[model samples]
Target: MFNNIFLLMRQELALSVLVFLLLFIKIGKERSNTSILNFVNIALFVNLIIGICFVGKGELFSGMFATNALIILEKNILNLAVLIISMQSFAWLKNHDQVIEFYLLIFTSLLGMFFLISSGNLLIFYLGLEMSTIPLAAAANFDLSKRKSSEAAMKLILSSAFSSGILLMGISFLYGTSGTLTFSILTAHISNNPLQLFAFILLVSGFAFKIAAVPFHLWTADVYEGAPIAVTSFLSVVSKAAVLFTFVSVLYKVFQPIASTWYLILILLAVVTILIGNLFAIRQDNFKRFLAFSSIAQVGFILIGISGSSVAGSASLIYFILIYVFSNLAAFGVVSLVSALTGKENISDYKGFYKTNPLLSWVLTIALFSLAGVPPTAGFFGKLFLMMAGAAKGNYGLITFAALNMVISFYYYLRVVKAIFMEENEAPIEKLGIPLVSKMAMYICVAGILITGLASMIYDYIYSLSFGL
Candidate 1:
């Protein structure tokens, strides 16, 4: 019983303690804010280690919550994400006056995500979801100097509220019909009735908004453009990935009975998301907006994996998300560095970037290749696994369409690559003196992306997780 309790709340407990300690350091007689951040980082690193070591899979809280390979995987992923967010964004935060408040909000949001990932019931999930989102709106408005930031905050809050309402409506329908909110019980209760079908659609559609999928993705570009780069990266990677993880879990675990039906719906959504994201990405001059659309397209591929609704599919989906975190963060790291140094974000501004800042240019190049699914990067293997998983489900048409779209994606990704490597600007970006922490973050991302691609152990472990279940 003690072991189960330890395993269950270890991550959250560690983080909550760290947050409190950090707050103490901030509000204490010592006016040393840097100490708070440094201590927080060290504490979080320790907490991540605790999560990895305490990994056990079972139910707690009378089965309202559960833990398993998926739960462990997601917690570790979130920990890694939070760590990177802290390290990479720390330099930027130090320059701003609100660093302490910012870190507090980030940790708060991360704590919420921990609960969301562990939730086994709709009630718990909704509680965690709302908890995670409310802080993020404040983070979006952290840049109070910009009107767009406040505008973005409003949009995010409104959209999140709307999505939550839709999700609750779906849950209400499920409860009305099935008389249970627990996913394990729901599988036995759910039937292919028209009301249940509509409920499931509401649920998936609500999550689609969270992940910024097509037809529900209207607010994404504005939010991405207006939020601080750190916040943008957080939203793009952590928030979207967590939502994807939970959404896939609920559907595959509870709604397995309607796999055939949702499969087609997912395929259709995937096609439109890919087409719209890739097509619009080509025309974007703002790098952040470019990433926004590019992310939408990437989510489409993720949908392909989810559509499989099998162990292989979940493995691939999880693997893809891991690499994606590294890839997208690398891109954002470069963009943040360049924007800080030169105030240039347009693709054209990248011309001759390689001449002055080869490291940033190369990092962005590698990230773009990975994003475009080029060979020898983790992104390539990520896409390959997702495709194979989809194909296993007889989703050849959807997979083929995705492949064609990949080719289309390469054109736009390479356009930026060409500007950096091939084109020349009379005034190129100046040389940069990267801080130690930011450089460490970049090296970690680059090494992880390369090693995960080259190493078979990574995929083998993922497949083991899939097969074990």
Candidate 2:
């Protein structure tokens, strides 16, 4: 039984241990921020490796928790994302007074994500969701002296409370209708009943808030702009990826019986999210806020793949998210470094940026190109697969509209590139020194952006794991 628990819940167990280790360190004597950061990074790297090595399939705690290759893979993707974020955050973490506290908050959120992914019961799912979400508000408030940071935390708390209430109401409705919270049992109970459909809508609303889908995305730009860059990266990449994984799982599994109904709903949400995200992205000046909208647009694409509701859809969505982790984090890495050094977060601050910092400028360009879905980058192929999956249902008109939105995305994405390489600033921000750790993280992201798309086997592997989904 212990062995089963160890193997089935290895990812969550390992993360929990890491969290406790950090807590102990915090309880002990004072240490330099650098030492704590290094220790935390090394420990997290080991935890990530552990997550990859032990792959199994089974249920624990009477099916409240479960694990399989695909779930394990999902957790691994998140592990990799958080590690990269930590590496990229070196520039900021080395200086922050409460480095250990920062990491604790991140780990707490991550532990929640692991549980959320492994949850086989709605009770477990809701517990995990709250665990993951509550810590983020604290992380957002980490910049304790900044008014915007406080405001960001306040907004996040309010929004989170609002969403959690809606989610609980939906869960209550679901339990009342189905008489059980177990996913497998719940699926057998689901139908096109008006009350059930309404519950599902409310549930999707809670998820939409997490993924920052349009209508619920009003809080995103402000939160991203106000939070520290590193926190913003976590919110954008790691947090979104975890929720998306669970979102796909819940839709594909628990709600499979209502496929026809949710399919149409996803279509409407995808179109509106893409259109609104692209239009708003074009108008943003703050770089974090710009990427906030960009991430929203990316979620819109993920939704397209999810709407396919097939093995192909599952495979494509996972693959796209893997690519997205690298592409989005690369963009945030640059933002973190620059914002740390110059305290400038506006688009205009990058004018003539390439002339002074050619390498960093190119790195940012490649990342933006990937995000814009430009050719030869992983993002292009990622978007391509998502569209193909979405078209699996013969929704060509929807695909066409999405394709058009991609073009609109290009205008804004390239607008930044053009500023970097072409537009001139009279006094370009001086060539700033890039820290070795941060630069390493950037290189890793760039390689991922370039290699993941080009490597067919990666997608094939994901597709294989998704076979029985």
Candidate 3:
């Protein structure tokens, strides 16, 4: 047992050491921070390579640290998200102080997420959750001059505390009912006990907060509005993906026997989240807040995939997340570029943007259309798979509601496109030159959105990969 723990600890520790080394190099230097950013990016890429090489399916540390193909894929997705986020950060971090510490926090937060996707026990999961979350709150306030940033930090902390408290209570209840905290043991122990049901509700509530499900999503818009665009993109993509991955694992492995109870609850939550998120997003003029609400609606669609609780469901969820990472990153990248150039985040500020920056404007248009489930984009296929997964289980109502929500979502998504192309400008807008690395990252995302749909070979590949899990 000690040897197993040592091995697992060593693997994670190596990544930690790399992160610190980058931090040291960053702070030890003087003057411009561009080199440090470049170094961090290289380090992240190397760490991802190491993670890929170390992909052995096993449980370690008495099942507290588990690694398998599914977890490895999830971690790789997270690494991709981090790389894209770091690229986005370049524009935001120019001339910013404490740049070294910022990169350190980002790496640390990512490490936490890696642990979280592989966590095998409740305690380990909670530890990873907090480790990932606390630094992000600080990151939200990285720009100390802005009062809105500070408010975002406060709201994040408060909401995280509330969710963590509820999670602890849920863990206590589960321990009391099953007399164990290990997931494998819990699967064997869970019965139709009322205590187990209560524990499930509590656990789901904690996940609900993390995923920004309706009624628990009041903080999402404000935080997205207040945080830097890079940070907001991280929250929407990496953080939410971790939570959903863990949620699906728990539901399928630990609580499978109680599907009837949880399924109804999920169905209700999915309906409300889809409806409310779409409705609220329509009124948002702030681009960041609009994306925030759009993310919420996307979560609802993913929930429909999850409700099926099959291997196909899990595959669909993963595929949806992959598509979303590209589409949303593309949207945010364009928004970040616009905001960096014009110092405006409002939708109205984009009037005649196409005339100024046709390349970026078209990128934004494709991203939004994909998000609205228009065909020939990854988003369309993602939604198609999700609806197919739900419908496979004879969930006609879920499919119907999801379809309706997609229609509602189309209006707001197109509104942005209209603002960019159709609306008249009062003044001549200057086109800004984007950094080479940032431009490459955005183009990569755009290509991903376009190609992922055309590649129908992935369906068979996903089926085979998820067969074991």
Candidate 4:
């Protein structure tokens, strides 16, 4: 019984234990100048190492939970994301009284995401989904310094609540029709019944909200502009990646039978998302809001892979997200650091930034260029693979529309680049002094962006992992 529950569930169990351990450390008499964020970073890094060495897969809790190679890989990617976010954020949280509360909120949400990513049963997925969304609300509200923090929290939770209702209703419909919560058996039972079709659309809507897909993305830009940069970064990269993977998993792995229906929906959704995201991005002044729309556009590109409907599509999505993690994090890291030092969050404020902060300027420049799909950046290849995967389906018209949208995206992405390198500022931000840990994290991100593009093996390995290549 111990082995059954503990072996495959090691990461989740260990993370739960760490949260408790953190409680003790927070409350214990020992007090010093040391930051708990630092300690948490170290602990999480160790967790990543342990996860890498963990070999094998199994279902736990009577098959409600699953831990497999793909799940582990996804978890590690998330871990890396959280670690970098934490490291870069120490300066922001160092003096806040709710530092313990901050980390707690993060871990709680992360634990929920772990369950969400690994669950084999619908009930377990819902449980994890709630766990993930709740703490993020609190985290978003952590900054009472500004009224918008509270506003962002309210918007996020309300959206989650509505999505939850839709999702739960859909799950009930599925249960009524299929009579099983286990996904492995779900595909066999699901038919083209109108009831089941409605349930699937409802389920897709719930996930679309989470992934910040177009129609459901009303809350994204405002929340991103209002929330703390660290929280916004977490939402943009980590949360989106998890939702995308889970969306892909359920559709590609479990519900391929209904491909005739949902894939068509995704194509329409993808075109709309790309066009709206890019069009809105052109008008954003707040740097975070710009990134918010940028992320939305990127999601549309990811949809191309999903609509492609092949192992290659799934593999390309995972690979693209890996590249995306490094690129987006690096961009946000620079934003966080600059915001901390100068209290500036507008793109216009970044004028003549290169003269003052070369490292940050270059990192942001490369990151944005990569995001724009410029050659020799991981994002370029990421888009290339996604395009290739989409092309595989012989849908020339859809791919052509996607390609044209990519051109529109380049204009907005380079707008930020133009601010950093070409535009001049009367009062440029001074040379910023980032902490060692933040610098290290930025270096890692920059390196990842470069190497992942220059080396084919990086993409090859990710594709191999997803496809057993």
Off by over 4 Å in 2: 467-469
* Top candidate when judged by TM-score against the true structure: 2
Give me the displacement of residue 324 in model 1, in angstroms: 0.2
Clash pairs, model 4 backbone = none
lDDT of 4 by residue, 326-345 (tens): 99999999999888777899
Backbone clash pairs for candidate 2 read none
The sequence of per-residue lDDT tens digits that candidate 2 reaches over residues 1-469 is 9989888888888888888888999899989988888888888889889988878899998999988999999999999999999999998888888888898899999999999999999999999999999999999999999999999999998999899999999999999998999999999999999999999999999999999999899999989988999889999998999999999899988898888998998998999999999999999989999999999999999999989988989899999999999999999999899988889889999999999999889889999999999879999999999999999999899999999999999999999999999997998878999988889899999999999999999999999988423
Residue range 1-469, candidate 3, lDDT tens digits? 6666544454466568877787667656475678777877787777677666655577876789897777777788888888887887677776677777787777788789878888999889999999999999998888789999999989998998999899889889999988988998888888779888888888898999999999789999999999878888999999999899888888888887888888898888899899899999999999999999999999999999888777788889988888899999999998887777678899988889899889889889999988999999989999998888878779797798899889999999999899899999987357878888788888889998998888987665665566313
TM-score of each: 0.97, 0.99, 0.96, 0.97
The candidate with the higher lDDT, 1 or 3, is: 1
As a whole number from 0 to 100, the lDDT of residue 36 in candidate 1 is: 59
Query: Judged by TM-score relative to the true structure, which candidate is superior, 2 or 3?
Result: 2
List residue ranges in candidate 4 displaced over 4 A: 30-33, 467-469
> For model 4, what is the error of residue 157's alpha carbon versus the real structure, in angstroms, after optimal superposition?
0.5
Q: Which ten residues in a row have the lowest lDDT in candidate 2?
A: 460-469
Question: Which segments of candidate 1 are over 4 A away from where they belong?
Answer: 467-469
Maximum-lDDT candidate? 2
Worst 10 residues of 3 by lDDT: 460-469
lDDT of 2: 0.92
When sorted by TM-score, best at the front, the candidate numbers are 2, 4, 1, 3
